[model samples]
Target: MAMVTFVDETTSGERRDALGLDIAEERLALRELIRRRVLEEAPDGDDTDRAYDRAVEAFGRNGFLVLVGDRQIEELDELVDLGPRTEVVFLRLVPLVGG
Candidate 1:
């Protein structure tokens, strides 16, 4: 499975200043980055790889998916205020077969 996480904040400049990343560009950039990573991780041309490729592409093109979650909570601001310690994770979701 693959996990990709990001904080949803309005401070585009702050994200750029703190992480040297432009949040305004992140929505697209991050998705592409995730797609590339998935491809790199699963280059064997298998179903899993194909699924991940489609997911990452969708995330990049659409901006959301069942496996991806985005939260805009003011309370979490405290965590970001604390500093880089705050991090988000994105994991791949797959259906379970037999129990």
Candidate 2:
């Protein structure tokens, strides 16, 4: 299993070890990682860096294994069985323009 943590492009160096994930018995799939980032208290300087650190710590702990999968708004409320050996992760992407 794998634990993923988010980091801004600027703070890529300090991202590791900040987010600890336990993956002894499970396998991790990157394609199905899903989650929403909600910032409660915005950091004054380098908010993305702070937010990434917090998000990694919060989501990577508790022996949780990430399983990537496809999800839609309609099936979001249902519990799916991707086999007993796998965990499910659903990530929602926001739209960006004028890159």
Candidate 3:
């Protein structure tokens, strides 16, 4: 079992909010984590597929960053350990170039 704390953060290192998710798996793929997070965050009746697509797109475009503990996750398919108290931060990117 694992307790994952999902945090919404800004590029400037400011945290906005957080929520918790309890999962039975000890490890999960980053893409799956993103999928679950998107589902959890999306409002009722929201288009989850579209939202997930956007999230992945953002990840690829460096629009946001996913950090697990002290390490930053670069690949969507990367495996992540979901420990007893894992903190996963989604840092929304602020464009420094090519606006």
Candidate 4:
């Protein structure tokens, strides 16, 4: 299994191998990555299903950006090849008009 680092800008949190996903596979889907992230960071005792749904919605609304290394992921179905030292960054996107 490969290890990956996860970084969240929304909560300013960072973790190594947070979800324990099997990076041994040739590729992984963005959806699975988002699901794992939400599952890893969701508050204890909260409904995981709801949290996952919210995360997916946030992705659709451009609430955040998922970057693998320096490359931005644009689709939920996009497949990413994992490396031993891959770093995934989830950056919250702020709406400028709201300010």
Winning model by TM-score: 3
Candidate 2, backbone clash total: 5
Between prediction 3 and prediction 4, which has the larger TM-score? Answer: 3
Candidate 2, 1-99: lDDT as tens digits: 333343221112322222323334333223222222223234456566556565455444422233234432223223333333333332322234663
The C-alpha TM-scores of every prediction are 0.28, 0.24, 0.92, 0.78
Residue pairs with backbone overlap in model 3: none
Better of 2 and 3 by TM-score: 3
Model 3: residue 33 alpha-carbon error in angstroms: 0.5
| Model 3 segments more than 4 A misplaced | 97-99
How much does each candidate deviate from the true structure in C-alpha RMSD?
12.8, 11.5, 1.4, 3.6
Task: Please state the error at residue 68 of candidate 1 in Å.
Answer: 12
lDDT of 1 by residue, 1-99 (tens): 123334333222232111222222323334454444455455475666576667656544533322223532222111221122323433322334672
RMSD of 1: 12.8
State each model's CA lDDT, in order: 0.37, 0.34, 0.90, 0.77
**Candidate achieving higher TM-score, 1 or 2:** 1
lDDT of 3 by residue, 3-31 (tens): 89999999677886568999899999999
